[model samples]
Target chain A: MIHSDLIRRLPASMKLAAALAVVLLVTAACGGGSSSGGGDTAGAAGLEGKTVNFVGYGKDNPWGAYFNGVFVPKLESQGVKVVDLTTMDPGTAVTNFNQAISNKPDLIVAALLDTSSTVVPIKKAKQAGIPVLVFDGRPDPSVDADVMQVLSDSEALGTAAAQNLVEGLKAQGRNSGNLIAITGTKSGFAAQDRMKGFDAELAKTPEYKVVDIQDGNWDPTLSGKIATQLFAKYGCSGIQGAYGMADYQALPIVAAAKQAGCPVGGKTGLVVTGSNCFKVGIDAIKAGTLYGTATEDPGTIAEQTADYVIRYFNQQNPPAKELVKEERVTAENVAQFAEQCSKA
Target chain B: MNVMSAPPRSDAPIRRPGRSRSRAELVIDAVLLLAVLAAIVLALTTHRFATVANAKAILTSASLVGIAALGLTLITIGGSAVSLAISPSVAAVGMIFLSAQSFGLVPALALAVLCGILITGVQGAIVGYAAANPVVLTIAASFAITGIATGVSGGSTVSPTGGGYDRLNATPGGVALSVYVLIGLALIVQWTLRRTGFGRSLYLIGENRRAARAAGLPVGRTTAVAWLAAGALFAVTAAFTAAFNTSANVNLGGTLTFDAIAAVLAGGTPIAGGRGSALRTLAGAVLIAAASDILLLRGSSTGVQILVKGVIVLVVVVLVHLRTEGSRA
Candidate 1:
């Protein structure tokens, strides 16, 4: 909020610059190893003719939709020929990496699943003198050091959502309630970190007791089923709040909350918050059915990740890690976030 | 009685529903009985497990797996090795179902089923006509289909929206719609296995391909038809699966394919090929759901759940093997 507030205070030209800086932050977190921005963009404009190879984890899932349908297209539209190498888990990442090294493009960007299997391929790419930008999951130093390791601040996202829920709980004149955490896949890094961040924040406040944490596997249907199960067990009046790992996970919880005879949003509804703002989540916020969600902003992340590298190539000076601005969207400010949420 | 109420009208070389009494059968039966008892104990001991909501969940969860198992049941009964591709094939069907939502669900569903039949029938032709190994071919086919489905959907989840197909996932009269669909389909499969002339051909071909071929039976044609039937079964199952999740998930079919194989084999179908029963597969599916539900209620992880399921399968296989060995002794 302070970040956006600062942007609001700045002049229009500076505001756009600050916004682009947020995208620069995306590259810094995962791979664009450095985070320093506001460097000389004098030669950055020369990147228009170069080709970039994107090796994304795109095996027929929603996240893949964003990567393939949204993120990749946005990059190619920047006048660069993009070779899309999207594959699923279980050796697909390895195959894509192998292909990238074979092609030896100007730049390589990827979203990886397992770091262990990719160490060899990534090292080979480095040996071939190609710079790699990785977003999504972080690569262990054992994997690569020279790469850009930009990732979403899932911990911050989770913390914000938790703070938003606690705010709702306080508005209802209480500090503690039976809150549930509907998590993503039990084994996924993103879900694990988000829950960790949530727990860390909630631990400071003793009143908001997390009664149960169920794994939703990041599926809305599974989330709905788990919510119903919790409702059936605790009844409508028993549970007070829910923190969904993703909006897709949280949206259905809202309906189930209602079906369980509990209101949603405002001071009355079970305070519900989700990370990764989807259109459904934004709509829920507008309808006052959901409390908050973090702006994942894949499009911005991809664009900035590529844009920053181009700037570096032009000036031969890498930017430091930049933090992509993720504001927790509540009903009071959901209108501002609506257009961004609509992109994917 | 219907298990015994069958006579071959084609002067079939092999009987469709004949059983050689073996102690392995009894042992596997005991193991299944033990699993049921374990679930009952959990239900009685836990308030949540015994609740109506939990009961419905168990039934609905099993329904999806059991429906797909029904098709695999036919394929195995027809002597095709378990098609690893069944899951991916069904997943593609789910994607197709999601894409065709604007044109009306029923029509889309029929079209999807027809396509599934064609794809599966091709697998059958490869195995039957080319004499390609069923296991290898179907595994390859599964990968190919999954790859294509992933490409078409562009890695996006096509979830069902609006009230147009709400009844698909509705739980009517305290029973999930999927449960009814499972029962109806299971009954149809059972009937097909018992009453149809094509049904007897499956047993003959599976019993001895050379013998059936010598008898002038259309081996390739029967194999393709069997695959077509199984494909139809899988197409309907995929629709329910998509409806269950409210989205077309590419990974939806992966877990169920093996679970369905386990269910059919544990339900009373022999691995070497001879006998199969839809009722048994349903029981196996129920057992799996009940076991998984109780374990899940106890807060088990997905890895643990998978381990438990694998253990049950291993136990059944081992018990069957030991009994067969002891009988020979």
Candidate 2:
């Protein structure tokens, strides 16, 4: 009876084994091995052959695409191999970091979507002896030893943007009017800092009293939808100025303003300022669609991040703990910076 | 529509060996298989989809979903409905374990399983006691579990770092482990359904609770047990997901609730319950995964994918319902 039962199960067992073998073979054949290739600059010293993992929030976003296509190539010319791992959502970021850590990659370049949530993991990466590079977002002090934060000065960016908006509004003969602050996410580093800086600057200009401050969560669709309600509820007659955290988030809002037939850009228009220096944002600036924005060249971040990773590999003290620069872009200087700022 | 009320007729052929399968059954399976096959072919034609790597990615996603689908299969069989919280629960469990065990894979897995069972059991008991609408009950449970996950992980991602990432990314080998676990679950479910009196009691209860109780079957106990079994399966599949993904986010199991229900329906399992098997459900999951991969490779946006998924599910459900009607005729 036992022998017969065993014989009866043989085909099923064989089929399972065969299926497993197929999976294994495929995995092996595809070079799905643990990233064993260490940090090696075969030809160029900075980043030619190295795989710099970029862990960020949304890889599908156009901004993410620019980083991969345009920015990473710029890094490549600087000798760095950029492996875009930006799909590490709120759920997978830690595991992604761990994967990079296990692979013992030369360096980890990450964007902490929520500064608070990513602190522990960044600190853990630091503990694992992996040098970290942070961009577009701030890092908590707890993970300072392990990280080199490269961020745009939100205060400077915000102040400069506010100044530009002030000048634009003044040019329009509405020197100061009711201003509304539209932020993508209310709690994040960039959002919070930008809002605070904008508020402080606007406060100095006593004529501009902040009328409304609402969070649009950095979504274009949501911002546009909200802009409609804000217009109706807050009365755009006195709403002479608008500040948005990012261009992508601001795009729809601008579209809504135009739909409402509100004045935009040229002399007597709704003065606005946004960040991220996205190509679309620059295009808007060039077309007198909006005021100016604080620009952090994304390509520079990728290149510098790659170099920092290589420096860690070489056991050289990784570049300064923080690489921040105040590069504000306005309509006046935008023409000169458009070539470098443009991202296809 | 009233398969349960339809009296057993002498003219009907039993589903035993030597009896050729019905034409309707063949048609249903053919249609389902064709859809799956078409997806694979489409994916193959697309360069990005044809690679061994992308294939593994699809399978990895499928396996995590399949594991949860198995639990859903059980709940479905038991006549209990649930929501997408299975993924979040899995994430919570994985994160709990990962956080506690210093990246110890086995312990984290065990904890995740335990948490899945306990949470599901609590939800099942409430469902059984109140006999509330499964849809509302599951939605409520989803929120509660999601809240707890957020609280536990503090809205932070709990992922396996260092060597943990390797074991998590071990696609073929890791996937086999999940598949085996699923097969094991299927075998146990099949055995319970066939050999154990409890299984029959559960099925009878699902078919007609009052009749089963009147017939001296322990209907309530069996129903609860069925739910409990589903809970166990849900947790196990969840662990497999965390293992495969190498991390669990607060929203890890969010997608499974809908996918599992859809898979159960597509696999010839009546939403009203009392019909289906783990094997059929697994096939449904594969079909769904295959379809998704195809659409994604075709440059379909997330919107298109969602629409297609809903349509496929509805079509499959309608076809299955039609098959049963035809079978009766």
Candidate 3:
């Protein structure tokens, strides 16, 4: 009787629309929330009393932790009130951006979580004349007018890593063979952009063919699994070079390949390289196993981001884009990064 | 040993509830036989299926899931559905293990296990003393542990600084220490299940809580102790997992809850509870690993692997439910 009365109270169309409206309203309410109250700093015009809102992605990630621990403190030392806001997903990123715009903080910095879902809200923030800072991802161009992006140059890093691997391969006196690449999540900006630069560098050498590029998902186990399969398919002698999108991903592939009787490095046979130069990878390079790796320090990225926000707060028109330097580290220069090896 | 074929007496006072032991044993034997036959098929056709390295890899992976599942199995056998808290709890303990490496690897690993025990023990106490729903309490515990873990590390992966972790990762004589740990834990769980007063009380509470209470049994204490033991087992799993990966991420236990539940149910444990064995779980672990290996060997994608796992779990649940109903008739 209750079900019949409820059904009779409203048409199906009205019920559907009412339910949808409730869902959207609930989503908007839940999407963006303040994660931490970072306390205030004291000073006049030195960013003391100035509020900087950082709209972040999920906290359970490398970027989230780096931005929180490293970036937040950097902002506070200059005497600023920092509100670190976070979202669970891309939709939440958009919602948080809108919530952030309503607050109208002196400046807004965010890690772009998605290409499509986050663009419109970020554009809305810009239309409202709130200066926006972004890192790690690029949104649509029309929406990019008031947004300043600060991130690593993926292409240059990839090219440098590729150059190291190709040269290592040539040192082995191997002219013709297939080179396999393991990338991060295929949909991620890093994978697509870095692969573009890597493929271009590989193309410069006509003898080495880019045979297969598989998605390692930036997970060590998945990368290792894919490595074993590739080794089985290509055999030890047929494959010449290997590239991993990150040091963590590379470590497992190297381990699996070794267990499968496929030796790597110049001394053994294959040329292997990793990016995001982790301490372990540096050790591998020094041990003459890894050919090279590219370093894009997370702390450095956080520093650049904080500097950009502070500059915008200091009044003058700041640049729309800021990119940090990426260094290619190999056995020759591995000693240079030894002091910061354990930072990762 | 032959609970299935033992002489049946009409006036038996301590018979296992629901289906007769023989029928349940029959179903389990068929499932295990199929698992073994499948492995034999793969060893005959797949190139590396029988190799020591591949076998070690499969066992190492299985052993982690197996240890966690064994802990959850106590909860399931004791009449609760399953602990949703385990996967996140494992990840939290792994982080603890990595951070506590300042005190040396063994001491740090022991601390991590203690953390797991305390967390789940608290949950079990709440469920026992307050008579709270175990599933709901465990779900809350999962969130609590994950939140704590995320706060501790700021949600990033961490690795121990000391170079001695590699020793834990090493497999002596081509067989991983993880496999031996699994076997030992399974044996311990079996002994506890059959040879202890608390174990029998758990069976009674699972069968009928009201009856257990009326019979002057300490139901709440027994339940709490079982959960506490289960928690320790879960932490041990996390410890070995940290050793295996040499790093711990927030999502390190990805797909583990699903796999554990599947392995438990597919291993012939009834969802209705009351009668199940730790020995059954060992066979379940082998079946799950063999199934996954065979699928991967045949180049099955993630979707296909999941599909097969789902179907197998479904077939098992249906068979158990029908068998239970048939016995009631």
Candidates, DockQ: 0.24, 0.02, 0.17
lDDT of 2: 0.63
Stretches off by above 4 angstroms in model 2 are: A1-344, B1-57, B159-168, B171-176, B244-247
By TM-score, rank the candidates, best first.
Answer: 1, 3, 2
After TM-score superposition, what is the CA distance of residue A258 in candidate 3 from its true location, in Å? 6.1
Between candidates 1 and 3, the DockQ winner: 1
| Candidate 3 chain A, poorest ten consecutive residues by summed lDDT | A35-44
Rank list by DockQ: 1, 3, 2
Model 1 chain A weakest lDDT span, ten residues long: A34-43
lDDT of 3: 0.72
Per DockQ, the best of the predicted structures is 1
The top-ranked prediction according to TM-score is 1
Report the C-alpha lDDT of model 2 over B67-181, residue by residue, as the tens digit: 6777777677666644446655665665665554464666665666677678877777666556667668777877687666755444544544433422433324423445456
Give the lDDT of residue A309 in candidate 2: 57
Candidate 2 residue A317 Cα shift, in angstroms, is: 41
lDDT of 3 by residue, B174-217 (tens): 56677888999999997887777766767667777787678777
Pairs of residues clashing in candidate 3: none
Q: How accurate is candidate 1 locally (lDDT)?
A: 0.72
How many Å off is the CA of B87 in candidate 1?
Answer: 3.3
RMSD of 2: 22.8
User: Mind sharing the TM-score for model 2?
Assistant: 0.46
